[model samples]
Target: MEATDCRRAFPSFDEPALKATFDITLVADKELTALSNMDVKEEKILESGKKATSFNTSPVMSTYLVAFIVGELSYVESNYFRVPVRVYATPGMEDRCKFSAELGARTLEFFEKKFDVPYPLPKMDMVGIHDFSAGAMENWGLVTYRVVDLLFDEENDNANTKQRVAEVVQHELAHQWFGNLVTMDWWDGLWLNEGFATWMSWYSCNSFYPDWKVWETYVGDNLQSCLALDSLRSSHPVEVPVKRADEVNQIFDAISYSKGSCIVKMVSIILGEDTFIRGISRYLKRHQYGNTETGDLWKALSEESGLDVAGIMDTWTSKVGFPVLTVSEDGNTIHVRQNRFLATGDVKPEEDTTIYPLSLALRNKSGKVENINLDKREISIDLSKYDASSAFYKLNADQAGLYRTLYPPERVVKLSQAGADNLLSVEDRVGLIADTASLSVSGYQKTSALLDLISLWKNEKEPNVWMEMLKRFGAIRKTWIFQPESTTDALKQLLGELVLPKVNELGWNFHAEESLLQQQLKGTLFSSAVSSENDKIVKEALSLFEKYASGDAKAVHPNIRAAVFGAAAKYGDEATWQRLVDVYTSPKSSVEGLAAITALGGAKNVDLQKKTIKLTLDGTVRSQDVFYVLNGLSTNVAGIQILWDWLREEWDAITKKFPANMGLLLNIIYICTGSLATPQHLKEFDEFFKSKDTKGFDKAVSISRDRLVSRIAWLERDVKDVEEWLAKHQSSTKL
Candidate 1:
C-alpha cells in the first residue's frame, strides 16, 4: 500500500494526481466485521452464506491511502472532538491496542488544531496485524501497523514500547491530514508528503508525551541518521526526479523521511517556530484536498514570514549533498564558507562550485548572540555592532541547522574545554559528537580530534549525547579493529580505557526511578565494554543472564535484556546460547523476540556465529527481520567476516528467496563493509555487491563502498597518530 503498489490492489489510474473515490466492497465470514475509509453503506448475507459489506464512497484521494480490512478484529474505541476513533487487532490483543487507539484519536485532534483543517474523513482505524511489514503503513483512514509498533501491554510493556507506539500513531495520524487530505502532485514531490508528516509527528508526539522527550529523540534518531547517510557521495538529492517506478522506492529512504524533515526544521529555525506553524496551517487550508510541489510550501511560508524561504530552500532541495562549515574568526568579522560535503574526501569536479545559503549562530566575546545568513559561496559577518574586539562562536547552536561544523585547532581545544565544563547544551553536544564522528571516519579530521572531544565529554550524562556518543564509539572501533597487526593490541587497549570506565560507573543494576533513556544507555555502555574485552562487565552480564534464565530473579529490566543475551552468547557456554534460543522460541512480546534475534549474532566463536547466520537464512529468522542479524553482527568482529562469507556462498539462493527486497539484501552487504580495513576486505565486499542485482540498493551499495573508501583513507591519514597513541595506552591484556 506504499508508493506505486495501488494498481495491483484495484483497477484504477495509479498516478498520484489522478485522484479517485474508492467504493470498496468486501465479502467475508458472517462473524467478521468490515471497515473502510468511510462509514458502512450496507451489510447483508449473500445466498452463499457469506457476509457482504459496502463502504460509502471515499472522498477524492490518492489510491495508496484507499484501503479496507476484514477480519475477526476487536476494537478499542474512543472519540476526538466527536469523531469516532478505534484501534483494531485480533481479539486477544485488545489491551495492547488501547494505548495507540487513544493516542491516535488525540493525535488526529492535534493535527486538526495545528493544521487549521478539520479531519476530512469520517473515522480512523489503526489496525495492528501479526504479519505486517515495512514498519507501519500510513493508509489514510485505515492505518496499518506491525504489532510491535502499535500495541503495548500495560503490564509487560516498558517506556520504549509506549514511546514507539505513540510516535508511530502520531506519524500515521499525520499522514491522514498531509497525504490523505492533501496529496503530492508527483513522485518528485513525495518529500512534501513524507517530510511534512515526519516533521509534524515529532511535534505532535511531543505534544502528548513530553516526558518521553520525543523531540529530543528526533535529534538523535532522525536527524543524526540523515546526517550519517546524506554526507555520502552516493546520497540522492532530497527532491529527486524519477522516471521509473522501481526508482521511486530507492528515493523513499532517509533522504526523504529524515533529511527532508531536517531541512523543514532548519527552515523553521529561520522562520520562527510559531510563524512556521502558522504557515503550515495556512498552506494546508489553502491546498485542502489538492496537490502541491515544494514551491507551494515555500510560497506559503514566504508570504507569511517574508523571509524568501524559496530562494534559500531551493538549493537545499535541488542539491545532492550538504556543506561542512569551517567556522573561523578573523579580526572583528566571522567568516562562513561552504564546500561540497563528501565522506570519501574527493569532490567531483562538477560539484566544486556548490554553495549553500546556510545559517550560522555566533556568540560575541561578551556572550551576546547574533545570527548570520550566508547566501553566497562565502561571507563574513561584522561583529563590531556587539562592541567586542574578540568574538567567540559555535556553529549550529542548538543543532537546529542540518550541516556539519568544523573548527580550527584552537577552536577545537576551546570547544572540548567547553564540553568538559558543561557550557554546551545537550543538542550542541550531540551535534559536535556526530560531526566529529563523521569527520574522523572520512579522514577530513584526524582520529585524535574525535578522541580528544569524546575524552572531554566522557562524563556527559544526557541521553541523546550518550546514545550518540556510544554509536560514535562503534564507528571509531570499526575504523581501528582491522588495523595492522602491530597496532591491534594498542587499538583495543585504547578503546578499553576510553569506554570501560563509563561501564563501571553505570553497573548492571537498573534503578526503578531512572529515566527510560538512562535505562537504555546502560546496555549501550555495557556492550561497548564487552566489545573492548572488559572481563568484569562481561562476567557481571553473564551472571545476570544466568540468574534471569533459571527464574532466579523477578525479571530483567527490558532495556538491558539484549545486551545481557548478547554478552551471555559472547562469553558463556552452550547452555547459555540455548537459553537465548528458548527466549526466541517463546517470547513474551515481539519486542523480546527482536532482542533474542540480535543476540544470536553475538556468538562467542566464529563457527558458532556462522551457524547463527545459517539459521537466519533458514526458517528461524523472518525475511523482514534479517536486517537485525546483519546489523547486530557488525558489532561482533568475528561475525562480520562470517556474514560476508555467508552472502558470497548463498547469493543466488538469497536473491531467489527474497526477490526485489533490496533493503534486506543490501543490509547484509552494508554491514560487512564496516569492518573493511584492508584492500582485500575492500576487494571482496565491492566485488560481491557489484555482481548482484543491486538496483534498489544503488545508494546502499555506494554507502558501503564509501565506508571502505573512508576507512582506507583514514588508515592512510591517521594510523601513524593512532599507533603512537595506542603504544602509550597498550596494556599487557591482549584484546
Candidate 2:
C-alpha cells in the first residue's frame, strides 16, 4: 500500500493528495470477521448464510492507507488508552500478541500527549500478515506487519528481537499522525512521510524506555548507513524526482529513511528539542487530513523559530550528497572547510561545488557547547576565548549534523584518548570511530591511521561504540577476502584480541536484572568472538549447540543462540546441518526460524553451501524470506563465491521468482553481487549484465558498481599498509 500501489486494489484517483473518505462493506463466511480502517457500525446475517459487515465512514485518507481484511482472526485488546487498541493474528497465536498490544496502546497514548492531538479514530488494530511485504505497512488504523516483525516470545526471543518489535510497532503507530493525518502531496515528498515517522519513532521509543539508549544506537545504525549510501556518486537527492511508478521503489532507500531522519535530527539540535516538537505539533494540527509539500513544513518551522528554515534546509534536501568538514588549527583560531565527499575519493571539480549550511556545535572540556554555523565554503573562529590550549574541542558535538568532521590526525588521537577516559558521550565516541573509518575509505586518511585510532579503544564499554568498531573491521575483512590466507588470519587474530576480553567479561548467560544495553552488548561480543574463530568461544558454542540440537531447549541462552547455531554450522558435519534444517522446518517462534535460516549460510562445506542455496528455490523458503538466506550467504566467505556462481547460473529463474517491479529484485541484486571487490569480479559483473534489462533496478547496479570500484581502490591503496600494521602488532595480540 506504499508508493502508489493503492491503484492495484481498486480503481480511483490514486494520488496521495487526492484523498477521500471511504465507507467499506464486506461479505464473508458467518464465522469470519471483517475489519477496516474504521470501527464496524453494523453486522447482519444474510439469507445465504453469510455475514455482512459495514464500517463507519473513514476520515479523509490516501487510497494506499485504505485496508480491509476478512479472516478467522483472533485479537488481544487493551483499554489502557483513550480507545481500544488491539493486536490480531491467527486463532492459535493470540497469546503472542499480548506484548505488542500493550506496547501499541502505550505508544499511542505517548504520541497523543507529545503532539497535543487526540486519536481521531475509534480503535487501532495491528495485524500480523504471514506473507506481507516490507517490514510493516502503516495502513491508516489497520496496520499490517510481517509476522516476524510483530509476534514475539519474550522468553525465547533475543534482546535484539524485542528491540526490533518495539521499534516497528512504535514506527507504524507514529504514522497515524505524521503520514495519515498530514499526507505528502506527491511521490517526490515521500520522505516527508517516511523520514518523519523514523525520527518520531526513535523520539517516542527513547521517551518510553530511556534505558534502551536508542539515541546511541541511532548514531551507529541510522546515521552511518545514510552517510555510506549517500557517499556514492550514483546516489540521488533526498528529494529525488520520480518520473515513473517504477522509479518510486528505488528512492525508498537509506537516503529517504535514514538521511531524512538525520536531517530532522540536525534541525532539532539547532532549534531546541522543545521548540522543535512545538513547531511540528503546529504543523500537524494545521495540516490535519490534508496533503503537504516539503516547503510547507519548513514554513511552519520558520514561523515558530524565527529563522530562515528553508534557507538552511533547502540545499540539504535538493543536493545529491553531503559535505565533509576538514578542520585545522592556527595559533589562536580554528579553520574549517567543507567539500563534497565521495567514496571513490575522486570528486571532480564539477562535483565539489555545493556548500552546505553546517552546524559546528563545538564542545570543550568544560562541557559547554558553542553554537556556530558555517554557511560558506570556509570559516575561521577564535578559540582563545574558550581556553583552547588547556582543553580539547570536538566539532559537530554529539554528531547532530549530516556532514562528516575530519580533524587533524593529532586531534583524532586526542579524541580517541578522550573516549577511553570516559570524557565523551556515547554518540561522540561513535561518531569519532565512524568518521575515521569513512575518512580512511575515501583516502582523506590512511587505513593505518584508522586502525591506529581504533586500537586505542580496546577498553571501550558502550555497545554502540563497539558495534561501529566491529562494522569497520568487517568491511576491511570483506574487502580483503581474496588476499593471502596469512593476511586474513592476521586480521582475524587482531579481531580476537580486540573483542575476546569483552566476550569473556560478559560471558554467555542472560540475567533477568540486566539492562537492555548490556544484554545487546553481550550478544554482539559473542557473535564477533565466534566469527573471529576464538578457540575458547568456539568450543563453548559447539558444546551448547550440541545439547540444544539434542532437544534441550534451555541449553543455549536465547541471547547467544544465533551465534551458537552459526558455530555449529561452520564447524560441524552433515549431521549438525540436518539438525539445523529440522529446526528451521519446525521453529518454536518466527525469530528462531530466521536465526536457523541465516545460520545455514555459515556452513563451511561446499556441499552444505550448495544445499543452502537450493533451499531458496526448492519451496522450502518463502519468496519474501529469500533475502535472509542470500544475505547470510553474502556475508560468509565460504559461501560468497558459491552464491555469486548460483546467481550467474540461475539468473532467469531468479528473476522470475522475484519480478523486477516488486522492489525485492533490488535486494536480490545487492545480495548476489555487492561483495565483489577484485577487478576481475567487476569485469564479470559488467559482462553478465550487458544483455540484461536493468530498467527498474538500474540504480542498484550502478550503486553496486560504485561500491566495487571503491573497494578495489581501497585494497590497492592499503593492502601493504594493513599487512605491515598487522605484522608489527601480531606479536603482542592475545587470544
Clashes of each: 0, 0
lDDT by residue for model 1 over 428-511, one digit each (tens)? 778888888777777677777776777667777777888887778667667777766667655565667767777778775776
Residue 327 of model 2 has an lDDT of 86
Q: Candidate 2 lDDT, tens digit per residue, 588-672?
A: 8887877888888888887888899998888898787888888778876668898889889998898888877777888888888
Q: Estimate every model's Cα lDDT from 0 to 1.
A: 0.76, 0.87
Q: Judged by lDDT against the true structure, how good is candidate 2?
A: 0.87
Model 1 RMSD in angstroms:
2.8
Error of 2 at 270 (Å): 1.8
Residue 606, candidate 2: how far off, in angstroms? 0.6
Off by over 4 Å in 2: 732-735
**Highest lDDT against the true fold, candidate:** 2
**For each candidate, C-alpha RMSD in Å?**
2.8, 1.6
Candidate 2 pairs with clashing backbones: none
TM-score of each: 0.93, 0.97
